[model samples]
Target: MKVYNYARIIYYRSPLLVQILAIAFSLIIIFGTLLHFIEPDTFPTLFDGVWWALVSVSTVGYGDYVPTSVVGRIVAMLLILLGTGFITAYFASISGIAATNQQLFLKGETAYKGNEQIIIVGWNERTKGTIDELLTKTPPVKIVLIDASLKENPYASKGVHFIKGDATRDDVIQKANIQAASMVLITADQSKDEVAADMQTVLTILAVKGLKENVYCIAEILTSHQLANAKRAGADQIVETNLLSSFVMINNVLSHGTSPSLLNLLKEVKDSKVCLQEAPTALIGATFLDVTHEMLQNESSLILGIKRGASTYVNPPTSFKIEEHDLLIAIIH
Candidate 1:
């Protein structure tokens, strides 16, 4: 019983393709063994019997080794009736399962089972561009897009999984495997009014936090007043699209091609990013100039400034001291 249990565990643990192939091979071996014993004169060796069985099971009548006796013919008839049909069904099942799984995935019925994936809510042009940029990453990031409007996964070809449900709902977020996600982005739903969209974004953030509180979340707040609401609902960052666009537009108007230059600069800095990290132990109590010089000389990273608690100071005075619990803001290349 223990051996049988162990065999069952091994069989179930194998991939579907390997399990199917094992069964097919087992059937072929049994049929070949039967054929060899039934007609020793016709099939002189076990390999010859296996060859005949293989050809018969594939329905490819080569006519190389014909069974002469009545018992041998019965064995051939059984192989044709069972083995051939099973082999035909085997190929059909493989194709059918693959097609069915694809359809299910596109329909957003399948749950994402991977870890450290990025989940973006709302299906808009901005989200689409974000997904394209994230996909350009070297190791390939898995992104799950959740929206209630889309009938099926529009970016299925690009390997983006879709969940066709309201992002504010716990069940829908669970389908995305939210607990294992690295970050969640709640884009404002354009279908709703500005205020309602921000409300929905905040709700989605709450739903995501309910499942995993520590997961970082970014929400888009169309209305300025809703920014605080989004943060209160567990949003780590809030993107003010209108304010940011207006800032860029005004700069572009004041100086022609300013937006283009800024965009190019952003693109150039893709390989190097501004990041905040806990201050190293050695940098404790060090002056700004001392830390900056040491960081540039040894680490090649620019020391932007020190972040003490909730306040961030960029390029503090040369005499300013770094505390023990301060975070260092730097541009890492």
Candidate 2:
């Protein structure tokens, strides 16, 4: 029973190509041996029978060795019928398997072995647009997308890995190698109710924070009331996308063209876009105006505000001094 189990394991583990080649070789040897015995008088050597079998199976009859006996001819005909078909089918199967494996690999079904990667959890209408923005605007970075709803990776792109699993699970978070990830984004599950979706996001944030405390987490909240819960769950930043959208739409209705300019500021074009970057160590004591002037001269950046602690001060007075852990909100071209 143990030996039978071991044989089954080996059979299952062996690649299709190896199995096909083994079967084809065994059939060739069996037919060749049979032909040798069928016409030993005409076929002087067993090697001659093998040579005829090989050529006949491959459909490349050189006519160097011909079977004379009726039984030998029948064997040859059998080889041509079975062997040729088997070989053709084997090659076709191999090609198909290779193509499928390649597709799976591209779809991120395979395990990822990347470090300092960005992991985006959940997929929704906004997911693809966010991914596109990151790919176009940010520096070259590997992104691993995690979602249980997706059948396969939607992007199938370079520098992107997909893991099909619930982000709220610790095992799934670990599979994405969240500990080594630079950042994690938990998008709202739009399919669920406002409260339910936010709770799901909070759960995922907790799972990720439990695994890696220092990793930056940005979660999308559907309702304003869930912001506190998300923050308590270890989300470094919470975005109320629905509220922001409402604000933008209302502002556009009140004053047209204002929203477009605001939207354009976020778009990546002419290498100019708004970004929130950490303040350099050298700019710790510099005033806002001084840093702004220096950035224009050195980095070609326009200092818009400082994100210090949990507060954002846009277009602060020039008297405001750069803090120790301030994030510079600026536009660069």
Candidate 3:
């Protein structure tokens, strides 16, 4: 049979355990002094001192050893008062440490880096849908999600990584690798004010832009009023859910019947149908008309818009010329 290691157990238990032991030892010293004065013959021997100290400190008060003298009894009262308080505090500290360590291990500590990856800031109600869509539509794309409330892995996606921290802080942004990220998406927190959400989004955009001026950033704002504010902060794209909802509602009213084709066109990959494809750079120097005509001839995709440097030209006329570094957003067959 193997004996358990007490030293190892004590080392890992808690820092306060040592202090508790000290308090108990001090009380034993006081009581031993009293016993010596009252009756030197009955005073605890070395082994008795150790045994009695352990039993009494553990609250296992045995009646075998009794204090008869008035001074000895007074010393016992002092031990009762101080020892109980120290033991309670030590247990509380141990509990707190255990809880903190459990939380960190569950959430993980790996930071994000590299390029062609998506960074999501601020988790909210729409986050689940957004994550599901990104995973289903864009396979093998790495994603790093940053939020303060996240204490564990929220989803089981292979490419999703969670970072437990405040998204507004620059350190958190750097941890998420904002500089090398292909796209940064700021989800609006419904619990916060439209202005406050926009402010947070703008601050994140500024941080990413300051680090890497070419990183693409998309911010979701609650209202149209915040659109200009987000744009001014260096966001390449601003999405207003309210505006999109209104457009859908208006279209449904105008045509006595809702067009499934129109709805399908509006539906993003989140709906599990349309997938956004990044057109190859080989199409550079090609005319918009030629590209559209070829797409129609090949029955491959519908060219929707062209992104130049930091600007996006939506529904550009046929004569528009495509330049290098232009990202063409289209629906894949």
Q: Which candidate wins on lDDT?
A: 1
Instruction: Please identify which of the two predictions, 1 or 2, would achieve the higher lDDT against the true structure.
Output: 1
Better of 2 and 3 by lDDT: 2
| Candidate rank order under TM-score | 1, 2, 3
Write model 2 residue lDDT over 1-333, tens digit each, in one string. 999899778877898877776677767888888888898876678787787788888888898878887888988888888888778878888899889877876555676778988899988878887787778755677889998888877777556789888899888888898878999989999789989999999899999999999999999999888898899999988888999999899998999878888878555444677889988899899999999998889998888899988799999999899988899998888
Rank ordering of all candidates by lDDT, starting from the highest: 1, 2, 3
Model 3 agreement with the true structure over 87-119: per-residue lDDT tens digits: 667777778878875565458455765667788
Where does candidate 2 stray beyond 4 Å? 1-18, 30-52, 60-65, 68-71, 92-118, 135-165, 170-183, 210-216, 246-257, 268-284, 323-325
lDDT of 1 by residue, 1-333 (tens): 999899889999997766777777777888788888888889889998988988988888899999999988998898888887678778987998899999999998899999899999999999988988888888999999998899999889988898889988999999999989999998989888999898888888889999999999988899999988888898898899989889899999998989988889778777797888877799899899999898888888898888888898988999999898998898888
Candidate 3 lDDT score relative to the true structure: 0.71
lDDT of each: 0.89, 0.85, 0.71
Worst 10 residues of 2 by lDDT: 265-274
Model 1 CA RMSD to the hidden true structure, in angstroms: 4.9
In order of appearance, the predictions have TM-scores of 0.76, 0.72, 0.54
322 Cα displacement, candidate 3 (Å)? 10
